[model samples]
Target: MARPLKDPTGAELARLNLNVQARFKAAAKAKAQTHGMTLTDYLEGLIAADISDLQAATGIQEALIPKSA
Candidate 1:
């Protein structure tokens, strides 16, 4: 039986504009492909993990979360 799709993270997203060297971009793309992940998924995983680490180190969870408008 198939289940209905749901919002994966249930959080709104904001655009991130990064400027990296061409080599770095290609390296990240290759790493994502090697791990069988789309570049977007791989980058999201990385950012989320980093944020979790930062939250743990700083003990300021609210600071990391986006401010509600």
Candidate 2:
């Protein structure tokens, strides 16, 4: 069995090969840095926030902390 040891956050990370415009990526990275978060964390937070509502309806337990109602 392969040990999933690379991710220190305890979540098994998956690779996502996203292709975005260079300008968009630069903007996102700048925003992430402005907020004192890594680019990955900022993107993950955005995805989590977007799906939090659906998560309640479907009973999907996401690792990210959902917004308070």
Best by lDDT: 2
Per-structure clash totals for the candidates: 0, 0
What's the CA error at residue 65 for candidate 2, in Å? 8.4
**How many Å off is the CA of 5 in candidate 1?**
11
Top-TM-score candidate index? 2
Per-residue CA lDDT of candidate 2, range 31-51, in tens? 776766566666766775688
Model 1 stretches astray by more than 4 angstroms: 1-9, 53-69
TM-score (C-alpha) between model 1 and the true structure = 0.56
Cα RMSD, each candidate = 10.6, 7.5
- Model 2 regions more than 4 Å off: 1-11, 53-69
